[model samples]
Target: MIAALVSAGAAVPVAPPGLHWSACASGLPQECATVSVPIDYAEPRGDRLDLAISRIRTAKPELRRGVLVIIPGGPGGSGLNRPSTYVKKLPQSVLDRYDLVSFDPRGVGASSPVSCELAPADVTQTAILPWPGPGGDISPTVAWSRRAAAACAKNGGPVYDSINTRNEARDLDAIRRALGERQISYWGVSYGTYVGAVHATMFPGSTDRVVLDSNDDPDPALVERGWAASYAIGVEDRFPDFAAWAAEHEEQYHLGTDVRGAYLRLADRLDRAPLPWPGANPPVLDGNTLRSNVLNGLYSDARFPQLASLMSAALAGGPLPPTTAAPEAALQNTFAVLNATICHDVSWPRDLRAYARDVAADRKAHPLTAGMPRNVYTCAFSPGPAEPPVRVTPDGPPNVLLVQNLRDPATPYRKALNLKRALGDRARMVTVDAGGHGSYLDNGNACGDAEVTRFLTDGTRRDITCRG
Candidate 1:
């Protein structure tokens, strides 16, 4: 009767407004569609923008329950490639029961992509990461952040202002409506966990089953800056995992057998005398660059070997590994959105003297990350207009499931527990005795994956404590 009334051209209610899908350029089984959402939800009828959406339908049509939307990490992360990644990891039961959906959030990949056109010198990991100079000088990063923020404001257009967690959550709902579903399930990781939490709170009834892996503190006041500050402790907590690995394989890659001391000393040594290498941007491998690379590799345990090998080669004076650079346009888009989303999400501390004091203290306390963790991003200098952060509380449906590693280098266990406590009876917390950025399929923790899969499939919940 509802469909009849709508199709008969009568004023009727329906979702997704107007959705048209066809073959996606990915050449995979996934079909892609463009969704239109208000640029400003406050003025829903004023301006609209396209949101790129993709879906991989279930093989068993009869078993299809609803949609499972996978939210990607990073203020700049893209989810369009997630279907392919999930094909290998998600259990067959999940594949049969739900149509998997993922999207590149607003001002991100293929969807009114945002760009700042930041200088090439400032684009690489070391430079972008805010590693201090020998004098512990972070003035450059502050200056850089100011300029980068201005560049984004200039090149990013209005869409840059539109890129944020809340808007992204709104975009997910728009996608859900487009798919003709009254409610949707979510699996969000790292930064996505925050996104999922906000979505659940904002549209409590619209969220069915939510799995927030590697959760962040939704302490509305701190927001992403809290996540950034925790890296000091986060890196401290997880560095032991890397240290233990280095200790076990001392013979293979011997910077030293001292586990932790070796990497530190090597970093110090490299800082003074950086190794000259060919084909690398800035054309040299300095201590800061090496540390930045190590930080990136720690996100996944599998990358440890490559990171260790690089350290060994550099220490042993062997060949330099090939360095790949993303096209300038792509890099600009990523940084632009990253800056816009982070700066626009919440206000950050702007006092330069305070940062200096914190940096000095952090460098002394957590040498693993140095002062980089507390270092400013573009947010500190150019905290663009901030949306009131969504206050996450246990006011929604009791359908949230949080999976977190005990020692995540980015989100950390303590932060996860904070969120878990905030959720109270509305969610179940599953703790994994592991060390990595992502907890489920990305890590080899079978228990964590099983818990998540069971929750999604059976609608069951129990707080689980599992082995790595």
Candidate 2:
């Protein structure tokens, strides 16, 4: 058993002892263990938090190269369950060569989870994302941000303040030491891309083959802030794919040949008179909900049918589509971590007028998003970061491979290039001709998957664009 090693007056070791492994309760073919890390790395002797880690060993032990760690998305996303989940999708060749491993970062599931204790209404997607009022007014968003920020401050305690991306990178290094691996490979998605990049920059020698899928800009001045604002550009890039699909299926969807125009008109109509949704959290299929659904639908082509059906139902005066509330506890934890990471990572402008102007401009420019991307977040009211943001430098070895979809809604292609620019020659990209949040092992594009698989299995390197 892993002893209760960290305590008052105890000297924290330079490297933690090996993890005490056991069969996971989930009954998947993976082992589970707990890794104890300091809440504050600067003060290793201080309070510690437990991180849940999991692993699936390579069957071909003689051919095994190293561990491939899966870093999950969102400041709140969990990775402890990934080993079992990814075993199905991962290629046998890659599985044969590397053990699949993952962990829940602090403030996420199975780790030392933190929560703001936010009310159910406050943690809704509409409230958390900062969507502006109908006429592009951001005053309400500002008010909500302030309230949420205060709740997090009062309820989140010390662990919340320690949940920045830099510290997450530090936790990764700690995991490496506990695993006793000289080097490990990583596959990071969405926000995980930023975390992975920071880890590589901070501990370059510890990383072997790195794969960053669906990346975001790593601008030091604006890390998480830039990611929030990129939704406008991402929506614009990916909406066309949805629009084209909806337009082609107009006969079935019944949104007319001008599907985009129909969508805007329907949204405006719903803004004035929302249909009652029986089981939804807010219990209304309002304009903001419609817009939010569109943003989510653009994440994958597969979800297009569901999005279209929702719109079609609303447009045709049929029954409002059903909605399910995310688990209240999970929502609270996710909201807290999101604010803790983004708000504590860097300082955000506190001027509401400045945010108002940005929202106004963004709403006028991108009607689809209605200025949510540029609106205020809880970060505006939260404290500045404890340390400067980690700058992703190009000094690392050239073992990083970035695979991006041309029209990813969450991390648009244009912004993803900024990360490529930040990495310089240390990384190469494989831009796939597809539209989704994840490119490799997702979107089902053979060419894109082949490139990433080749790189992960062996040390293949190149900069290329894959076509459908």
Candidate 3:
């Protein structure tokens, strides 16, 4: 069965011209394909999985320096769709010089999927993620964690235990080998930054040029804990952007001329009586949803107006908008995979009391985010066996360039600073004075984009910081 699966995956299909590529919402054409990789690297001769890969070939193939692999954020986010969303955003010169490639990592879209088969009620976005209650009460969080873990344990197989960053990095190397490339270039955003960092560390010789945007702290000691706690700082760093937007559109949003006052007013009202959001789990607006929406909005400033409008309607005592739902089959599987990968990658503190104490403190320090940052979730519920964590150092060749947003919410500047320090002479950092998740091509200044394009296309980088 393993040999047959491997042989089947090894076969690449041919595409027929125009139908092979299409424009994404970002207005870029993308070509798609599938790359077969071993599900378990240790058992390379065994069963294999298919990874859905996408590419937007360079406009001028003659000028192409090399392939630029894009690593998507989220142990869960799919990169299979990004080449289309991002191809047009690339500077023409960059597009003219390199093939933009991306893939959905294992346990993701079109990859050999693994599902926990959780019930809809058991896996509602809020319940599955475990946002702590107001005032840091985690009784409900504990209950949900146990239930979710049990469901996964019963339904998830060996594949569940196999999902981890180290394995994902290994899969990436396999992809590189299959592409017949001696060395590959990279552009990683958010969680993808961590993936790029690990890949660079694990197989430094296989890397040509690398870019890590909106970086994460590669602290082996606390991985997810560090990422979660960073939210307090991240929210503080990015709230100014939202504040400015609210203030700018005060007439339209009717929140307030003062951003702080407006935010406080909204928080108070939501705490007292959250507006009804049809189809939402628990059936009403709450601090967690509000917090989640705030973080989600920070990923792109364009979403700010939507958030403001929602807040305005809620303030007017109107029914909140219906909650957005994806196919449960897909989300449950993705969420389960994300949990397995995160939990299996590192060992988390198992003490429930410790989590409670930390969450309490976090709530006090950052009320806007509440205690969700420190709340217990499935990651801590059923952690898999520990694996060696990858250490990203600055010993590699100086082919890496990093572009970062100073005010990113998901991946804050402080964490990027840590990554920069770790990379040392191997990388040159381009700091964009912007607010949002990704910096390069998306939400990044033209100067920053040009600098990255030049680096990716011509192997030239500017040793300068961009303010605005």
Please tell me which predicted candidate would have the highest TM-score against the true structure: 2
lDDT tens digits by residue: candidate 1, 42-146: 889988888888888888977776778999888788888687679778999888877888998988887888778787777765665677765467887788888
Q: For every model in order, what is the number of clashing pairs?
A: 1, 0, 0
- What is the lDDT of every predicted structure here? 0.81, 0.88, 0.76
| Model 2 steric clash pairs | none
Estimate the lDDT of model 3.
0.76
- TM for every model, in the order presented, reads 0.94, 0.95, 0.90
Clashes in model 3: which pairs?
none
- Model 3, 1-468: lDDT tens digits are 111222211112222222233444334467666667776778789877777777888778667666788897787888887777777577777677667888888888767788888876776666655677655788888888888788888988876767888888888887777666667888998888889888988877777778888889888777766887888789889988898888888888888867655665676667677777887665677666676777788888889988887777777887676566667887787787778877887777778999899888887788767777788877677865557677778876776788888888877888878887887877888989899888887864878888887887667875677877
Residue pairs clashing, model 1: 16-177
Q: After superposition, how far is residue 445 of candidate 3 from its true place, in Å?
A: 0.9
Candidate 2 whole-model C-alpha lDDT, 0 to 1:
0.88
Clash tally for model 3? 0
Give the distance in Å from residue 128's predicted Cα in candidate 1 to where it truly belongs: 2.9
- The number of residue pairs in model 2 that clash at the backbone is 0
